[model samples]
Target: MKTMRFTPPGYGGRRRDPEQVKRDGWREQGILAVSVDDERLTWPERELVRQLGDRLYGPRAADDGGRHG
Candidate 1:
């Protein structure tokens, strides 16, 4: 399973690269997507994963599945 390191801004009082953060966040979401289905995780954990996905990717309409609608 792919895993993403949870390194947020201000880690060790250092500056961050926006582009890198975006890339990492996307990868993190992909990993979380798989992790969310893991039976080992509790309900709250799964909920948190869902919330993160929502926050990172935002809501999607049925017709807006990647193309101009």
Candidate 2:
């Protein structure tokens, strides 16, 4: 006689990356892409996206055309 053993699904599998998980969730919801200038995002969210963009890529032109007071 042979013994059969089964392990639970995803019990010993590699952990999924958090970023990938977020991307997957977005894909599932039909969110193909998001822009920093998207009006759907709140002011704070847009600011965060702008900061991330600066860190990942480089500084971008100010929306006010460099006018600061």
Candidate 3:
């Protein structure tokens, strides 16, 4: 008898595609913009936007209030 471990597909921290990463960056930027400028995001949504911005650009990413190229 052999013991087996289940591993999900794309596991082991597979790198995200570059284009997908770029799109994600753009989406995060949009979310942060709406949260800060339009007051559109709920608390949780705003937190999520902040986290995404930190991940994509760094801590300062959200500081500009989503104004970035």
Per TM-score, the best of the predicted structures is: 2
Q: Which stretches of candidate 2 lie over 4 Å from their true place?
A: 1-32, 63-69
Residue ranges of candidate 3 with Cα displaced over 4 Å: 1-37, 61-69
Question: For model 1, how does the per-residue alpha-carbon lDDT over 5-60 read when each residue is reduced to its tens digit?
Answer: 77666565565686566567778774322355568789998778766766887744
**What are the models' TM-scores?**
0.35, 0.44, 0.35
Task: Name the weakest run of 10 consecutive residues (lDDT summed) in model 3.
Answer: 31-40
- Candidate 1 vs candidate 2: the lDDT winner is 2
Task: Note each model's CA RMSD in angstroms.
Answer: 14.7, 10.8, 12.1
Q: Report the lDDT tens digits of candidate 3 across residue range 9-67.
A: 86765688865776687787752233433365677877777778678768765476779
TM-score of candidate 2 relative to the true fold: 0.44
Ranking by lDDT: 2, 3, 1
* Residues forming the 10-long window of minimal summed lDDT in candidate 2: 60-69
Clashes of each: 0, 0, 0
Q: Write the per-residue lDDT of candidate 2 for residues 1-69, one digit (tens) a residue.
A: 976476688677688887577688787986444578889889999999888888877877665468775
Q: What is the alpha-carbon lDDT for the whole of candidate 3?
A: 0.65
